[model samples]
Target: MQKDKRTSLTDGMFLSLMKSSLKGISQVILIENAVTGFIILMAITIFSYPLGIITLSSSIIGTLIGKLGGANENNVNSGLYGYNSVLTGIALTLFLTGPSQWFIALVGAALAAVFSAAMMHFMRNTGIPILTFPFIILTWFMLLASYKLKAFQLSPGLVPQDLSHWTLNISGKVDWLEGSFNGIGQIFFLDSTLAGILLFIGVFWAGWKYGLFSILGNAFALLISFVLGGEHSLIILGLYGYNAILTSIAVSIVFKEDHNRFAPISGIIAACVTVPLTASVATWLLPYGLPALTMPFVLSTWLFLGARKVLPRL
Candidate 1:
């Protein structure tokens, strides 16, 4: 009897260790993915390149990783949708200044991973509904960095310039049309035309494969924002949509058994809603003398709390 009990205890200890190891693996994967995404974003920004190839490449990488990790088909499919990378890309665009800024990007990525893991833990324990922790953390970090550490500038025009001159290869009539299309598209579509289309495709595909109703929930939220004439432009909306896709993919992989049930849905929603929420909050908070060093931590905490409440419901 004593031997049997010892065996049982050993087995339990092994299981616990394994679980902790798996959690650490997931966190490492998230950080690596974020760093890779930052590198890709920097390449595009500095080299004046289109993001299509990089985006697709990253999706492929994510899908392969999911598959190799014994993720289900749905998880692989969601990873291919490209939402996490989109979040990383957006963060890189906003926060990256030069090669030296890679350290800061790493800091942001580490915090993002912590936020994501804590969110998952909270949702598991508390039965909360969360869908956008990544964006919430990322935006808050950028905002605080901008104000306190001078990590970034508040130039919303940066995206426009990058899209127009560096990436799109537009010139002459093509340039004019592209510029006009982007502007008009932002007013109506919710991002640059290409990004909007990609986001729509990614989200629609995930919804079709998994939860149609949950997808509708996300769509309804966006529609309400649109109808209310929310300040989010098409470009910004596209970014949100892209982030949603990545979040869905990540959740699907991490919570393999529950991929189709609530994980993807919750993750997508959290990612989609976080942008506007953070931006609004940041606007109010920045003027009050928040330090840059604390921004990432604060945002991570809020996201962790919100996710705890939001993820389980989905």
Candidate 2:
């Protein structure tokens, strides 16, 4: 009977860890459903098999660190540690190209978990979620490190330019269907139309309301960027849409409190805010050859969430 109990306990722990790792993928979008994460994984794999592997591998690494490091069990199970690692892993793998990129990507993923733990410890009293700040900062640092490191190679798509030479060009026709799907796909650093559709299915699978917010957020961001005369190539490519999708979901659904009565309205506003934020952040990073990543989402979400502390109804 004692041996049987030990075996059962081991199996239970393994199952729990698997579930947490899966939840970590979905948690990238601020959802904690394992099934949703699995669908998202499928979507990612369909577009890039390597990315799909890193996504799940990074999540598992994060969960394992949290589990073994004696962190709060609830936080580990909630997939909080896994999300940052997921983003970090994907970003590093995509932004850096070399034989050692895979190794660096895994290392970055592990560090993301540690970084998230540190951030959580520091922000515990602030009554605000860290969101993907750790991922954003870590990715920027690692990408910048490529400039000095011999083993790290930056992708050709990222080219540093003199601000004096920058020119604004906002002249291209938008592909509505492609833009619609690209927004969701870019969340995982993807641009595949099929992957985007699958991502939407995964989101709706989590909850219809969240799916609605995501669509509304992407649509609003695209429209706002178009009207604001953002570069047509960037707007149509869904560069501006990913941040809005994240902000809308974070503000209205994920971080919302039961007592915050106007969360939905504020959520839309926050989503739209990301359009301009994206342009500004991208331009700021142009000199360094860095993509904006999720800073726009973090900024807009933090804005509304911090405001709600002073006026709880916001």
Candidate whose lDDT is highest: 2
Q: What does candidate 2's lDDT look like per residue over 72-169, in tens digits? A: 99989989889999999999999999999999999999999999999999999999889999999999999999989979899998899899988998
Supply candidate 2's per-residue lDDT for 310. 94
Q: For model 1, give the 10-residue run with minimal summed lDDT.
A: 180-189
Global lDDT of each candidate: 0.38, 0.93
lDDT by residue for model 1 (101-137), tens: 5444444444443444455557665543233455355
Candidate 1: list runs displaced more than 4 Å.
Answer: 1-86, 95-99, 150-190, 207-314
Best-performing candidate as measured by TM-score: 2
Q: Model 1 — TM-score against the truth?
A: 0.41
Which residue ranges in model 2 land beyond 4 Å of their true spot? 1-7
Candidate 2 has its poorest 10 consecutive residues by lDDT at: 228-237
What lDDT, from 0 to 1, does candidate 1 have? Answer: 0.38
